[model samples]
Target chain A: MKLSEILSLLEGTLVSEHADWDLEIGKVAAADLMSDVLAFADPESVLVTGLVNPQVVITADMADIVGIIFVRGKVPPPETVAVAREERIPLIITSYTMFEACGRLYQAGLKAVDLES
Target chain B: MSKVSQVTRLQELVYELEIAEVMTRDFLSVTPQMTMREFKEFLQEHRFSGAPVMEDGELVGIISIEDLIEALAAGELGCLVEAKMTRDPVVLKANDLVVRSVDYFGRFGYGRFPVVDDQGAIVGVLTKGDITRGLLRKLEVEYHQEEIRRARVNHIFDDVSSDHTSISLRYDVEARNFERGGRASRSIKRALKRFGLPRQIVRRAAIATYEAEMNVVIHADDPGGVITAEIQPDQIVIEAIDMGPGIPDIDLAMQRGFSTAPDWIREMGFGAGMGLKNIDRCADRMELLSPHGTRTTLRIVIYMDER
Candidate 1:
């Protein structure tokens, strides 16, 4: 899905100045463990997590995650926001819990890449 | 023994710091009314990067060794804490996640931050050294965990006698997604380690394999391609197969500045034609094969002793 469309669907607040209007998203993983995310997330997708550390941004930077979403009312620290801005990956804040958020996106015709997609 | 470069370089550092067992007890104090001579002496006595300043028993500010040095150079040792100390020192609670400490490192590149108590009393000092050592310790622990994962990756490949023939990854191309792009490689690296591959081999293979996988998704149109990586006792082979119309000039494609990747890829600091060169540079042996509708296959060999 187009990043623009995903942002609108998730009720996201864009925290990045470098987000492309045309960047497409290929997959999404919702978790907070930086290691788990690093160990598992498909680097072709966005990271949706309840955690709000700057490492999230650093990890995103290292992995090239297209975007970061802070779920369940978690707010990013200023440094976290700054890194996101510098890396130009979109940072979004969503009030949905991880499960609900993942479910909503999963059901929103927001299909994740199948092992064969 | 030349591997001593990596192994011995860290020994003295680890040895010196191991003495204190990484003290977290933030024992320090400085009074603004204290003489400048005294502050400079405190800096020297404690080997301080910085110290918190107090006034009437109240935490008022901080004096960094940097500021003290600057004062000395400026012939200002007689200067008061008000003059030499930073009025506001970034302080953190003793219980703050060490990860947050890392964030501070990433953000301001600080050498240290003050640790304070509920009453604003300085409890201890967290040096860039301490945090870094802490991170190293944590990473060491994680590295041990990674050993298991490395085994898994190794089992996937080396245990040809086992079940890991092909890694089936489901991903989309041109998504500009960063986080998921390297997942398969992480797994691959872990498996390689499990198979007892050397760290150098693991690093080189991971880079070449991940870079190849990332390119497939970020640059190619084929979502149907399979990245098949295999391990031989002699070398590691990574094959990225896709149905996308292949590049015309293999040589030009190998050139460092010849990437046709979109602007986004360039902005990510990777899509430089160097991906191929980087793969070539890291691998002792590399073979890239592409035929129209052509799958790109990269073979990298990391010698056992090399790691």
Candidate 2:
């Protein structure tokens, strides 16, 4: 799925630059725990989480997570925004809860990280 | 010295150094007949940590203070040096490159290794300190030589006039400075656009430049390095040179999702391991010169006339 489409569907505010909005994301992983995000997220996957911290962006970088969507309308701290800007990882803020965000992405055909793989 | 010259000097040191040039020739050795107690005293008296145990002019084993402590703890302090010494210990040949010893040191965590002759005789000992001292000395000599070469190159270039036919732009990239990361690529893009290059060509160059710049920021050690873009009538060449802990496995680093970036760096969203691949796809030709644990130079050439 293109990041722009996901952004519109969630009615999210893009905190990151628009340069990466056209990027194609193949999967989505939603989790509050950074460890779960690290273990389950793959490259090009858009990470959906309620956790608003610099570690979210860091986890995205380490796991090659393409974009991040902060659910529950959480406003990330300035440090987190700075890191996201620097890393060039796209960030989206959404009013949707974590469960709803995951469901929306999944229903839209974004696959979850398959443990079997 | 200017920063550019310093970088060039360090690069030459990595390329020009060899173990034979640096390995100590005069070194201490102990005989297998020496008792562990005597060996301990020998190490203490000389302030040495270890010595090769030579038997009949051949290196049979190596004993270190650690071995002595082990023997003491085991209540075997009276044991012969042969009994306590490590048999078939790792050794480095004189002709080996200094980089090989560096790899050995990193992998084995050994403080010292015996330097041996072709005849399997201990000629000297190679310690971590020896490598550091040797490299420093080599760096001084190479830095002077590099300055001379740079002066000659500059002299040649001084005659060339800056015209529509050719132009060069250089940008200094600071490692991990994400704030300034894409400035070089953006500037290059703007330059190419102003030069009236086709949109496709400009896009490719911009993408390649951005990836190369990010690679420098992401991977280069310490203060980071520079990228130079040379535009000719026929082609554009972008060279990114970094004082690096160079890519250990070029092939692996080139893979789609391979990245060594730590979690924190990743969280900021930069390391996708797609930098090199993207650079490759955007350039007509690309060359990487990476001497592991040293410097890395990446050259990307895009032919303007091809399209």
Candidate 3:
């Protein structure tokens, strides 16, 4: 799924300048632990979470995540936003809670990696 | 004013003032006897700000979680304590004032200090945590000392903003020899994440940045050097240089047909006649400067649109 489609589907607000919303996103990992994401998640996935910190972006970049959806209408700090901008990470704001966001995206045709793998 | 008996001039109660007062006696310290891997495990077990090295009942040195963090940033392989430990561990005598300890720590940035007896035996240890408490306990000279302390940090990344740029704070240099590769690349990735660089851009930056580091390490031999990165709101620039082993042919090296990389580099999934090409593809601008013999300089740039 493309990030733009997800945003349009969820009616997500464009908090920052939107670029490359058409970037292809494969799987999604929802977590707050940066180390876990860096160590476990595959690159080219969308990251969904509410944890807002500079380190979160670092982990996401290291893991090669494609897009970051700030769930629950949470706004990230300036430092976090700064990192996103510098790294060219697309930051989207959505009112959907983490569970709902994940499910909606999944049902919307975004496939996640199997847990058994 | 001197003759008033109600205002008695009495001495304040102060402890014998040994670093031992804060040392964790139960906590095991890494001695020379342990392997480097064990020392890594030791760091993982305890969330210690730092630890003192003890050998046969005597203090030789000290290591901290920060040391390991810095070492891991460097990527040193093998017995690390031998390679990573700071030599001539600074000591705080039992009678030394807490002020002295603070000054020493503030200057040397020693995460922890060992309190020792006259017999050279470590009786206790002092950490930054202990020192922080010591500062708040005894009202410090707030104005001048505080300014002096913050000044030394020099905060190489101070002007950085997560508001528009990647804020990074990792270095992979030969500081203590614990580790010294992939640090610049790792930090760039972190900065990209914090700055919210888009996924494709972030990956391009990491690959481009890392290839530059790898080039310096493998080609820049015998000459000590560094790979420096700068993240402005508009772009990220990575420059790697070494004073040894200069490239003979820039044109051929840039070509996809020519490569001097060893078999090991290919085995590691690199040196497929692709380094320069990959970097060229990933970076906005690529520049190389070398005069033959040893030293080589590589520069890479990644731009972020203001939209």
Better of 2 and 3 by TM-score: 2
Model 3 per-residue lDDT tens digits across residues B1-307: 2534212311111232344544445656887666556777876677555677777777777776766677667775355575677778878786676656667877987667778778867777777676546444443444356556455323324643355544334354432121244557777676666555576677777877766665665555654468777776567788777776778888889886466767654443344455677678678888988875466788888887522
Q: Each candidate's DockQ score against the native complex?
A: 0.02, 0.05, 0.07
Q: In model 3, where do residues sit more than 4 Å from their true spots?
A: A1-117, B1-180
Question: In CAPRI terms, where does candidate 2 land?
Answer: incorrect
Model 2 CA lDDT for position B65: 91
- Per residue, candidate 1 scores C-alpha lDDT tens digits across B213-233 of 666756665353556667665
Candidate 1: what's its TM-score on chain B? 0.44
* Tens digit per residue, CA lDDT, model 2, B1-307: 7889777765666556776778878888899999999998999999999998887778898899999999999988789999888999999887777778888999988789988777767777888888878978877776788777666433433556555546899999999887667668767877777666776687678767877887898889989989999988679999999998898889998887888877765675557676787778778999988985589999999998655
Give the best candidate by lDDT: 2
Better of 1 and 3 by TM-score: 1
Residue B83, candidate 1: C-alpha displacement in angstroms = 66
lDDT of 3 by residue, A1-117 (tens): 777898987778765554597788778888764433543466788788786655456556655776788899998778778767876777888999999998898899888744422
- Provide C-alpha RMSD values for all models, in order: 18.3, 21.2, 23.4
